[model samples]
Target: MTKSNFQILLADDDEDDCMFFKDALDELSLSATLKTVRNGVELMDFLENNLSNLPQVLFLDLNMPRKSGTECLLEIKESEKLRRLPVIIYSTSSNLEVMDMLYCKGAQYYIRKPADFADLKFVINRTISLLKEKNVQHPTREEFVIQT
Candidate 1:
């Protein structure tokens, strides 16, 4: 993916959170494309149908209506076609155990939803930077949880 055309897919059920994320991306002025899916089912369908053009990164929320992000992560990791996709767990829960579980489940990063808009921007920018620098490689446990 080109630096100016980063593709991002966000799976979130919360309308306000999704709006906030989009607003943050707009404010950052990064030449990125953002596509959002409201639930895990749609997320999976989108990924499956767009196999030839997968996003550069996926920001997935843990809680959803039909399917959970945890289930989606496991499915993605298990699928050969989608196994390499970079997934960043984006949720409000910062529980160490849950983070550890997600890391072990093959998530590239974990980001606790920031309450402040500035912090949200910072974390999002940092995440994009890391993706560019690391080439979507799985980071160490210590580096997995990104904090603002």
Candidate 2:
């Protein structure tokens, strides 16, 4: 697919992580268009205002200033217009308890941010590939987290 074919949204407060994510995407040459929102508030605003062009998937960081990913997740899932949108929890923490909660709350997947650039690319690739499958849906507990 071309860059315009795959649209992705990322909501994270970390400047460095956003840069790293874009860099990994560049290195992979996967033709994915990524839009970054610094925090959950911005993410929600974008999502609400851009109803005509909703992203194919959202990569959300669990912690952010102003509003948290948990809050955003809840809001998104509660919205009839946004509930079907796939959300991938991209966070630094690997707290299984929190992950379980997020799953029950309706997030499609949880991905622990990879420290290595190559691993990050791999994880992103895997995620995009998996999402392309017709049968792709909320994963089982054992398959929820994308371990790169």
Candidate 3:
């Protein structure tokens, strides 16, 4: 899809965070459409059902209930149909080990959820730009985690 009409899917449990994310996207004035799921189970179901019409990017939260983002990421990578879809780990966790594991598991990038709305917008915009420029190619370890 074109940059003006980017499709984004977000798997996050917190209502406040979701609101903030949507608000940030709105404030940024990018013509991006966002779809959100409450947990990993829903996220997987959505992806499975929309195999032919997948989003340009998935912003996945790590600490969801029922099914964790790690499980979802593994399943996505294992699936032939979903393997190429870009997944950005949007989480609060800054644990290096977890980030490393996620990067190894095929996540396109890791973003520690920014506290400020401006930073959030910046990271999201930067991520979209990177995905557009890189075409989902795995970056080096040094560039795996995006710090805002």
Candidate 4:
């Protein structure tokens, strides 16, 4: 298959946050598509069913109904088919212990959801830049958590 644009998946239950993310991507003027799942179950279902169309990266919210982001991350890393996919923890929580566990479990990055639209745009832009550069597949411990 010929893929011309970047594919991004976001698993966030918050409707407002989801809208903000899509809006941010629209404002970036980048060649990328954003697909969203409201919860962890849907996120895993999409990933598991769409083996041929797996997204280049996944932005997961740590808090959600049903399975949480941490649970999804663990499952993703455990599955051979999904282990290589980059999972970014995008959440409002900044618990150091939780962040450290996620990093150790193979999440590519952890982004604390920014309150401002501008900050959200900046974070998304930075994420896309890293994806393009392909330098952060295995970032250092110091660079694991992205700060606004």
TM-score between candidate 3 and the true structure: 0.97
lDDT of each: 0.95, 0.90, 0.94, 0.89
- TM-scores of the candidates are 0.98, 0.95, 0.97, 0.95
TM-score of 2: 0.95
Q: Per-residue lDDT for 147 in model 1?
A: 94
From the highest lDDT down, the ranking of the candidates is 1, 3, 2, 4
lDDT, residue 125, model 4: 86
Per-residue CA lDDT of model 2 for 1-148, tens digit only, reads 3456789899999999999999998887677788999988899999999988898989999999999999999999999999988999999998889999999999988899999999999999888888877344788877788887
Candidate that scores best on lDDT: 1
Alpha-carbon deviation at 53 in model 2, angstroms? 0.5
In model 4, pairs of residues that clash are none
Task: Please give, for residues 39-104, the per-residue lDDT of candidate 1 as tens digits.
Answer: 999999999999999999999999998999999999999999999999999999978999999999
The number of residue pairs in model 1 that clash at the backbone is 0
In the range 92-135, model 3's lDDT, one tens digit per residue, is 99999999999999999999999999999999989988998988
Off by over 4 Å in 4: 1-4
Best by TM-score: 1
Model 4 agreement with the true structure over 1-148: per-residue lDDT tens digits: 1235788999999999999999998899777888999998998999999999898899999998899999999999999999989999999998899988999999998899999999999999887777667754788879887776
